[model samples]
Target chain A: MAGEVESIEKFLDEYMPSAELKEVKRLLYGKEIRLLEFPAEAEELAKEKDFELKGYGCDAARESSRLPKIVRIAGVQNKIVLPTSAPVAEQRDAIWAKISEIIRCAAICGVNILCLQEAWTMPFAFCTREKKPWAEFAESAERGPTTKFLQQLAQQYNMVIVSPILERDEDHGDILANTAVIISNTGDVMGKTCKNHIPRVGDFNESTYYMEGNTGHRVFQTQFGKIAVNICYGRHHPQNWMMYGVNGAEIVFNPSATVGALSEPLWPIEARNAAIANSYFVCGINRVGTETFPNEFTSGDGKPAHKDFGHFYGSSYVAAPDGSRTPGLSRTRDGIIIAEVDLNLCRQVKDHWGFRMTQRLDLYAEELADVNKPSWKPNIIN
Target chain B: MAGEVESIEKFLDEYMPSAELKEVKRLLYGKEIRLLEFPAEAEELAKEKDFELKGYGCDAARESSRLPKIVRIAGVQNKIVLPTSAPVAEQRDAIWAKISEIIRCAAICGVNILCLQEAWTMPFAFCTREKKPWAEFAESAERGPTTKFLQQLAQQYNMVIVSPILERDEDHGDILANTAVIISNTGDVMGKTCKNHIPRVGDFNESTYYMEGNTGHRVFQTQFGKIAVNICYGRHHPQNWMMYGVNGAEIVFNPSATVGALSEPLWPIEARNAAIANSYFVCGINRVGTETFPNEFTSGDGKPAHKDFGHFYGSSYVAAPDGSRTPGLSRTRDGIIIAEVDLNLCRQVKDHWGFRMTQRLDLYAEELADVNKPSWKPNIIN
Candidate 1:
């Protein structure tokens, strides 16, 4: 409205009182998980690296009895640096180079934990539905080169790093799975969780590559917070988000690689809704930019075949359990959003809202048992 | 940003392309169930009645074999015409008269199914916490004057009506429950569903009057569509919405009387999110204005005691399965939003989104069983 097209938040800010604006922000998101203003040195580095960086702080009302557990978390949304035709090693090395710099920037900004976009090490090639060269990109989750690369960065910066990658599970049968490996600040590789839900519509064609994640909703107990990852398409499933909260995650990162054409409308609402419904902080990190492939493809929508996956439209943002949210990052730029949130806010909002108290989990547990039954009938009163 | 503050939808419309604006509308609500344009006679009557009216239609893609089953549904939000000091019969008559006129208007507009706000016949008196006079409002769901009055109207117009009222169960120790009575088009007293999750937060204090709903997520299969009611505080629970969806509900009405200070932010998102997740139509109806009781009350918020319940901002609207929505009615006005929608869109969206197919019910069914256990531990990896 006043600034660049990306700055939609400024339009509301200019027209309304800060309180009312905060109300709307709170409706979509209330805990301001925005980009924190950097010191001059880091700003200079960001300028030099030609990447956008933003951050915010999610504060809790102070209590004399208990201290706040403020933890800094960062989400990086980015695009491929090199062409798909480039040698696989060079392409991965380019991403590694760019991410290493961003990780350094995160360290300077005091990010205690950071998560990269889904399959950050390679192109979003699931759309191709091809197996040969793309499957070659998959590597071991525990001892993969990507985890090895990030483990050093995690230890060096004393930061917890979540790396979503195409994992080659050699022990399981040389199968490939879309997975996120959590690297602790102590340079140890925590257990990994696979993408729970796979897309079958349009060009997502993820069913050809992997099935539903076998790992349950797993929360990694980190030095900063209890966190989990709802990878990519899993955001559409509210139950997936709910179980993670049930497992006592303080924060959940949605590392996704989705295009604007299929999911732009759902992008802003889903993660924010999950955060509000589950009473936890959520970081929605999406890959930016459209990548044109060497070959044409059809999305099965009866339209003409296309060469690209459409715009990823990166507008990564964060949501607090209180339903407060930060303004999203630039839709057209590679950027990272850093938010320092007090884990105490999670419990505080839960107490204030009483959502956990009122939510009748017993009701659903019984219903779901019947729901899974083959002879189940909906409770319809005709 | 454009005309009246009530028209927030206009701001986005004026600033962006129609398609992009449609995308935003699709996010919050896509099925544009809104008030249809009335005939000249109805318009004159609406003008004379001095009520705000708005409407829309939610369309579906054409299928060669199946015809579109467009059904109009209306939600009425209003203030109590007579103050609490007035005689109970006089107050009830005033509401009946006003609603009779609105129902007549709805009939003229060809509304197939209509739902009134929560506790529509009485002031939202749960804030007062005094039972002597307030409990007098509770009546039989089947034999109550409100049900009989609405039954005759429903039979006259051949339109189904949903009446949310405080129920007095004489057969069960005269207990009071928040219930919605479904009057079929044939004027038969269909089954009733009670408010599932009762509130204990702030001034709500609903638990003093009613326990959790005994009737589970019940869907009423009417001539129009299979629908359910998630009363007031139950909207705070995603599982409540999900269960109704599992019960094959095509539309879910959220009849609420929430105040601004406690729930204004959640008003817009919850029902809309339910629509998207559950692949159903959601009509979010809220009561308008503040009602001061004859006696003072404390909300237990550690604040000064007051006589009035805070304002019930009544920006009611409808959300479709595709995430499209109609613009809301005035926040501080007596109004009804009528929306014409095709129930087929629910299945269409489910087909497109693959949410039901990808949703791992078997997984949660197993997990929730453990979660319901007393000695269960979260899957937290240390």
Candidate 2:
């Protein structure tokens, strides 16, 4: 028996090259072997085959790790209008019908989550100084028709809905808040996150109409995953996205109603930046089409028909965790953008890149905290 | 005079529609104001021009805020390769001449910073790991001929030079480090940021030849602005770029010697991510052309020529802070890419987007520092 074994070994050694030894080892050991061997004459023949096998193994492994999970999201770019000459009742009915149409279509598309542009049930009223009548549209979050409609739709379609609206706290009386409601598929109110930053410039005379949000940053837990919303103009601020990411949001939405000229360039920059920095997918929805509203006020210089209301140019898009964007559904057409997002991609990217892991956050906190101080101004002028 | 003004306004109001009044305002303030009040209509226009402007007096009394000075910068992608297989002494001479030629040409084209491909002075030696005698081509960082030659060229042309090389740290007993050095225009050793991450898979076997970098994140201060280097495989890590940005780097260079098939895809992804996330300009330099060495190492598994060397497909490019890349400098041509980048663009972006000001550093720190056990394991059996 020993002679027979020796003869077999001699025959293998004579024919096999040292290079093929590792492959032969793998055949004997099943899948456990790290190295292998083969016959000298077989070396040339095995090269192409070995690479092909390795490529196949890698592809299979990547595919298995990347199991696809489909997610549907919907957004409404509130094109609600309030004609200066029209009564509040007439305006409200017109806007509500438009919003209802949006919600119905979103439900039909099988969206699990639907978000509306900032204050979806009303026109952007912060563009002028006229206050009292405009403020009348604001109501209690739970009592508002926008929330009631969205909540009913969530139950009807078994989907989570995000309703952004102007909230008038009856208890607080004077202060209005820009609030968003996170409703469950079962129509239960999950939570709410308010817009933290309010712009005080240009057409955004938000300070005249509403106070800055005081809810602090918050994320909602849902059946799909942890999610958060940064409403409209809040997308301009990176902290809004960062707050959600730190709180464990895997998906964040930036629901906005902005014009093409004023905010188009910012679209590509902000969404991708938020995605790459936080390692989370971002769904950005902008209102499509134009809304015409009658001018109610003149400029301080007594100029008639001072500023025609701006157009809400919609070009909504979704950015993946890898900072790549899917071709948008449309800016003009009200539609949903469906994508297969693997939550695992976030983990894989963060593990490999370690943006969050290696960041020296301590230094940034101390330095950036004082950057806006009056004393921090540099002498150099632009 | 007041009665005349009131009478004219009343007459206009009685005769013109509100839309016509809107057109009058545009005529007064629009770009075509001259056409609205033509000289033929009134030589009285010349008399009105002499009247003192309302805001002009205040503007004259108040000194204008000094504008920030703008400096134009040009980033050059130098696709370079040293003849490594040639006799060592002859190879060193050829490289020195090549370095001088490149610097002179780049300076003539008005490039502010010329970044060469990673380890341009030596061929990549990690293909098979046999440790041939020629592998000693990797030199000490402080005394390397490549570093010395570039330093001389920097002083000669008064240009900032970024040189990446296979560094053997003499102070650390010749410990190898993949390093990139940023030399000031005056030839001062500004600083060096060693590549922190070493890729272990695919065509990248860098860890086999060099250990991970020990230098804490660093940025070099120069006449142009703050600059940093992400050497070769380090570009794969977004945190590496973030570190540079947090340290106040305005321009970052990704010097890479990557091949066509494996790395070309990563090329578009990595640089754009770095630029968008950090809001800083990125210059990506890649080596061009196919390089074949004298010997091939068979796989330990007795497979024929297990490692077929890679072709360095050079698609060098410069990405603006907004993530827009200039048409890539040709991979085929060994030439300089020059673009006048306004340094003021960084400040303009920061002011507009407010990314740094709005970042929530405290929250990110806590999340990243939490080293909880992972929830999943590597899928090895796929």
Candidate 3:
């Protein structure tokens, strides 16, 4: 039996002939392998020889140049008074003041953006029968107080504001849309996107209050970068976020007002999922506190009933493209959470994960086009 | 104008005719709508009310059962003697004793399964000239001493052992296959899985050593459940894990002896990626210590050189399907980390995230088959 011996250089000469093995050799030579504690004599000898000892450890090569910029974001859970209240004007003023305070505090903390809960200025009024008079609160997007106030605040603090409201299109003669207004820092109304999908089941009587948003996925170019907003209930539909991403949204915001018993764990899941899938940053802003409105009138059937409202648990958070998160704001606390986000991290993640490079977008487009086909049904109640 | 007054009962009569409105009425009647507090008062109320809530800020439905059984897992980073080492029959007994001691200590900590680093019993002899004498270390799947000894200990302690070895088959003589031998608790040779993807890059001269794995992905059914082993470099491939999951592997083990500088961050990324993508538990084990061997000979160029062995970092860890990790076993510490894993959690995650439900497997199969087609390549890459 012959003993075949080969030095490290000989092995590299045979295996990596085309490459500059010297560079790799130079970088690794003489470094201590952190995982092992070598005998002092051996360590000293290795150091004397200038041989680099290598160990298993994390490399910061890809993460080196990327810097995360911290910005505060706030979500206000606004509760609107029922129509049966005596003075709607006075109630509206109080609600606006409360919302202003939230925006002001978020701006003071250097929040680049603040998102209000769904239908921020009003209660979920769609839960009741819609009378013609109830439409009074559904103001024009261009002329509404909510839009005007948010725009002014945007200019005041150099912040972008996303306000989901019952938008009345005056041009269409009182046609209402479930709309989200994006106000730019210069007090300009950049644009508005409507909810593409509306849930017809359960307590979400969204169709009764406003028509589905007509705008396709659109992101506004701001002083910071291109940003997009997906209103509450849209997160359940993954394509909504994807559409925003494909349209070049650097920062995507999901403004929501959901109760505590229904969706907390899913809270962390959604933003992370969106961030990873789209390779973009996701800000999940949830409203805190609770609201109780007065019952309209007595029951026709004489059954006992009382007014009830959702306790919006506030657990706002920001998820990076690689699915890492900064510590989120408390779900129970009514405060702002500021996180530094690096725009470069998106490119870094994309290069590393290669999801965008590997995504079959054309195939998805064809598949989604044929929505009538029967597919795998998961947790289908029907 | 007529003011239409409708009580909550009348509203429910018209809008929620199908709902058991009695439940909602019962929970809300005479109750103040205030924000819920820490211990999840809303959960208690909802449980009593017998109604399910679905939204943000809610706790997931608590499981009726207690926590699942915990098993500690440890990865042994072993250095194989390079093929150039002068064969010494007398050294086998000492080596066996040392390896046995490591396994015994791991078993004492309730480690049901211990995955030895790739080719645990022998050095990566392929680093130099290949000859028939190196085949002496190659072992048979059914009769290897490493397997025989580990099998005995497994039976004694009711443990399952995964031993990766340089394998030799007479029919295909000297064609090495980086393989993992699965030893069942009852001392049976369950089966073995060969490394699927072999890398030809870097210091990995795998092509010179072994043919690609003949067997595709495989999972072994042990007393503990179905387990699968992915060899060192195979961790870089995503489809490897996906195939294991489709074949019903509950726990996937990645046993590696990777050095630090070349690809360290990839260590944490690989295990967690497998766990998250496939919704299965992953145990990543690496060699924690360092090894140095005498240089047998010099290169033809006469540049003085020795066999430069790289240090293997030992940050072994166990990751849950939900992306939560028990603190990782330190790369510097020869220790164990144990955590109870609820197999049911996999189902829970799948149910909530709908990954499996939404996966169009047939389409993916077709796409992957032609992923490298010339037509599919972007012009820029070309």
Candidate 4:
């Protein structure tokens, strides 16, 4: 029996090999989100940049009344360009250069939108939990140098960019937030949504830095489609995904960072479940490579302190509303996954599945209210 | 990439083969749900009974404060015996006999709880859309012939049996429900929870015979542990699974009947996602084999009427609280899956993950209220 399985082969095997996947493109995902021909120069660009690049298509049966609104979205996963030994600005800038190559590739493939891994500009340093130079990485989301750089790339590429970062909220007492900033193709900082749930598990305790997001589920309506960002830990919460779908997001991106083995089993499950339940396109991007921090940190589990988080495992991919998905990128490498999806398929799936129509939200809302009472009791029958 | 994949190899590849899987038992899932030695005679019994029998174990570290509450749960997936051509009594009797062998096997294996596939005693004739003969399968939850038979078996085996069936409510104008009847090990009729979400997709639409359940998530307190049932279509609804978790269920059973390809991609994802999100053990049992109906029906998708609902694709398995799971049963065979779980792992995982602690129920309750309002707008940034 497959109990607590360890083989890397099993994780990669969840997705089909390229050749066989095409034959079953019509298996599900409402009207069959077909696999399109690979983008020209995809492998060449991947080989040149030393990063894995893969793409899939989510299509709809064109109706006479509704033109298929095809929107291409790209997700990138990469390690910190230079170690924490480098100056913060220089380190962030190195990532800027590394990510720029992927952004240009996304542009070459005509991506309408692109998303980066959580806190992409800096080393995932929350494991150290020290307050000095690490806090310096937090910046104002609106004016952050990372967001500004992405705005230029967005304008240069004529594409929307979602940049997840550690936001030092300037107006609100300068408290920090784990946030995703949305930059429009027109080079405007459209809006930002904070990461609602922060990790307290293992050494990934961001509560040492930021609290739960103050902002509710926020969906951004861009020229291409309606989208939302459920940062990192928020993917574990079904309601977080539910609210974004409730708000009519056609596509939801899970910009996440977690070590391998710790979460590899969960990686392929959650975002796909969200996509299936919410009837939306979902992109899951994770940070690649393990980084050795300048200082050692303890997980408080009686284990010796360590300097490095495990590999981030960069098997990012896209899932369509009909539950069909693209194969993940290499788990051991920096990579870019681009999926072109039709926004109309979201509504078509909702129409066919009738989940949104029959979701019984009122029943849950009433029960949740009852659960909140001080005298609340579980619905357990003895 | 893996877009709309069709090959059988891909799905089976998601699980590691036995020899390799045992190596990394502690990868995640808290303390790691280990694969224990197979029940004595498991292989021989499987061969003799002509069914697949597999088992895994979930263990926790020995603590000074509490003794381990080792509970063995079993899930069975099988087709209706003797066909609909036999009288309802004969059909039900044949099932009772076939299941008796498994019940005896569960007793030998010392299974604390056993759950059968959805509508196990019938031909899954909802696709026929006919009222006569099929409706005869609906029996009272408390006095249903199937439940009564299982009650006797439960007492005989000192086991709790979860029987999912077409329920004919005697007090409610003979209204039908897709329900799970919980019978205690001592032969008492404990309680029943109806299937909340009736699917409208494809030929699995139970709305043709029954409406959505009125009984909210009800967790039954058995001698072994607290358990609940999330019926077939309810697995598609995250809230349905969430409510069961909220009701303090230690183990949640999903007794489902779905055809291959229709939901093969989603089968391994949902229940496991629930177990991870809710910090509970989950058992997912799916009906095996295809059942051809007495008549043809159209899905209204412009295809000609069909007589069968494709393949049920039995791949029942158990998922532990920390996201590890047993390999699913053979997709083509009748089988039973047994997992020995220490319920304490649920709390240990919740402590380690803190998902339930940070779930923020009030926020969702408040937002869900707004969602119900006619003038409510999604928090969309244009």
Which prediction has the highest TM-score against the true structure? 1
Query: Which scores better on TM-score, 2 or 3?
Result: 2
Error of 3 at A247 (Å): 7.7
Q: Compose the digit string of candidate 1's lDDT tens values, residues A166-216.
A: 999999999889999999999999889999999887889889988788999
Q: Tell me the spans in candidate 3 whose CA falls farther than 4 Å from its real position.
A: A1-97, A101-223, A226-286, A289-315, A319-325, A349-382, B1-99, B105-114, B117-159, B163-223, B229-247, B254-280, B284-327, B338-382
Ranking by TM-score: 1, 4, 2, 3
Name the docking class for model 4. Answer: acceptable
Residue A182, candidate 2: alpha-carbon lDDT: 85
DockQ list for all candidates: 0.55, 0.04, 0.02, 0.49
- Clash list (residue pairs), candidate 4: A2-B327, A29-A322, A327-B2
When candidate 4 is compared with the true two-chain complex, its DockQ is 0.49
Supply the DockQ value of model 1.
Answer: 0.55
State the lDDT of candidate 2 residue by residue for A228-316, as single tens digits.
Answer: 88877777655556667766677788877666435553465566567766878777777655554455554233456554445565555
Output the TM-score of candidate 2: 0.69
| Global lDDT scores for all candidate models | 0.86, 0.58, 0.57, 0.84
lDDT of 3 at A294: 58
CA lDDT, candidate 3, residue A70: 40
Per residue, candidate 1 scores C-alpha lDDT tens digits across B262-371 of 77666777788889888999999999988989988898889898899988888898888887777888777889889989988999999998888888888988899899
DockQ measured for candidate 2: 0.04
Cα shift from native, residue A174, model 2 (Å): 5.7
The Cα error of candidate 1 at residue B278, in Å, is 1.2
What lDDT tens digits, residue by residue, belong to model 3 across residues B1-382? 0221211223333433232333222222211112212225534433443322111111123576745534444555433332334463433455565566656555544567767767766555444444455557777777877788888988997888888887876457646678899888788888888887675533455667777686666678676657888887767655556667766777788887776654553455556656765767777877655554444433233545557435566666666565554334444433333434546666665655444554444444433333335464311100
Best candidate according to lDDT: 1
